[model samples]
Target: MLITGADLAAPALALLDDYEVVFAGKAPSPDDIVALCRRHDPVAIIVRYGKVGAAAMDAAPSLRVISKHGSGTDTIDKAAAAARGIQVVAAAGANAAAVAEHAMALLLACAKSVAVLNERMHAGHWDKATHKSMELEGRTVGLVGLGAIGLRVARMADAMGMRVLAFDPYAKDVPPFVQRVELDAIWRESDVISLHCPLTADNAGLLSAATLAACKPGVIVVNTARGGLIDEPALLAAIRSGQVAGAGLDSFAEEPMTPAHPFHGEPRITLSPHVAGVTADAYVKMGVGAARNALAVLHG
Candidate 1:
């Protein structure tokens, strides 16, 4: 069996004892991937969502299954795989809790001004009362998508004494604590806005300048989901104009953000290296799930 992407190597290896595992040195080009597959002719291919492309599929005629290590299949060409009779599967819901916890961490960090306060302390300046910190209690949190991760965030926010309002077109009945509302209401009424939806063509720039303008002034925004969901330029402008009080972002439209990125210099923003779902526990669960899915397809 072949596994692309280094992030999935260790956990996948732990779950599979019978197969001889081969790891690509780096994200191989389409030609390199096809060449490797022609040489190996493995029964199954496991790859990170964004690393594989059409060339790899055209190269490997023997490939039966393409398993994704994570939930998002944005990087994979599903139509091509379907045409080729290839089965695609993902380890969905494996990292929901970890992601939800990380989202809340960002929210709390923004609400309490954790990054700014830490900087002040490091500078040897005692300014406790200079920055006013608000508690999560009595705040209204609007969740963009009430999937597993969003539902978990809603529960946590409720426990913290925050009223939870969620907007998900697919959700038929929300939990008791969460009030299901329209998308416009979520945008206008939320004190803190937490995004938990996937990035799609329809929702790619869901939080653009126009939408950000509709948000309540001084709104604290948290995005642990994909970065393209929020328009970075709009977010930067909102932060500068004081329309957004603060932001917590774990993902970016581009990875390994450039040093010249506008959000880099913004003290009101807390950034993470796309690590919201990278905890040890989540890694193990996802790895095991991927391995099991691959084995089931290969043996069936």
Candidate 2:
């Protein structure tokens, strides 16, 4: 067994005690991961973070399963795994509350300009508090996906007196509080837009310059999903033009290397190191889930 990209703590990882669980360091690129597979020929690959492409699949001759640490498997190529009879499983809904809470925190921080205000205070400037801050109460929030995390966010927004408009073509049994609306309607009416969708070929670059232009001016965007879901250049431009009031982003095209990131100095965006679903509680659940999934595939 091999664990790549991120840490999987001892307790849950102990489930694979019968096998050798190797941790190949952190922040390795897709090619690096494939090279590791070429050398190790691990029976199972637990992709906690980063990509597992066709080349990686080709490199793993002994691979029987590919287990994802979290809900979204966008970074792993499903087709490549399928071609080699590799079973791919993910720990869905295990980290829903953690991700939902992080999204809400981002929303609140942006609404209150927490990032900007804190910097101002540290810089010895104190006049910004008098400025108006947007409140969640009574504002319409559009959620791009209605998965477990999205549903959790919907429930939380309801408690805060915010209307939730969710768009999910395949979603069913949506609660009465959330209005299932078309994607265009969300762009037209939402004061805040939150993304909870996985990255797919059809939805990659979903929030491009054209779509951002269609959105209500000064709309606040919060994305905890894939970075490719939003065009970084377009988002940066929108922020500069004030078309986007602010953004709370937990993912990026390039991440875990924040010092040279473009969003590092941008006050209009509140950034996180993709740790939204990495709470202590979620980590255990994800690790145990991945271990069981891999063992199931190996035994079957």
Best-fitting candidate, measured by lDDT?
A: 2
**Candidate 2, superposed: residue stretches over 4 Å from native:** 257-260
Query: How does each model score on TM-score?
Result: 0.93, 0.94
Q: Highest TM-score: which candidate?
A: 2
lDDT of 1 by residue, 1-300 (tens): 777755564666877778877666555655666777777876777765345666777777778888877677766678888988888888888889999999999999999989988998999988866767988899999999998899999999999999999999997668899999998998899999999988888999899999899999999999999999999999999999999999999999987688888898799999999889889988887777788888889889
Off by over 4 Å in 1: 7-11, 26-35
| True lDDT of residue 97, candidate 2 | 89
State the lDDT at 77 in candidate 1.
Answer: 75
Supply the TM-score for candidate 1: 0.93
Cα distance off (Å), candidate 2, residue 82:
0.8
TM-score of 2: 0.94
Candidate 2: residue 276 lDDT (0-100): 93
Error of 2 at 174 (Å): 0.7
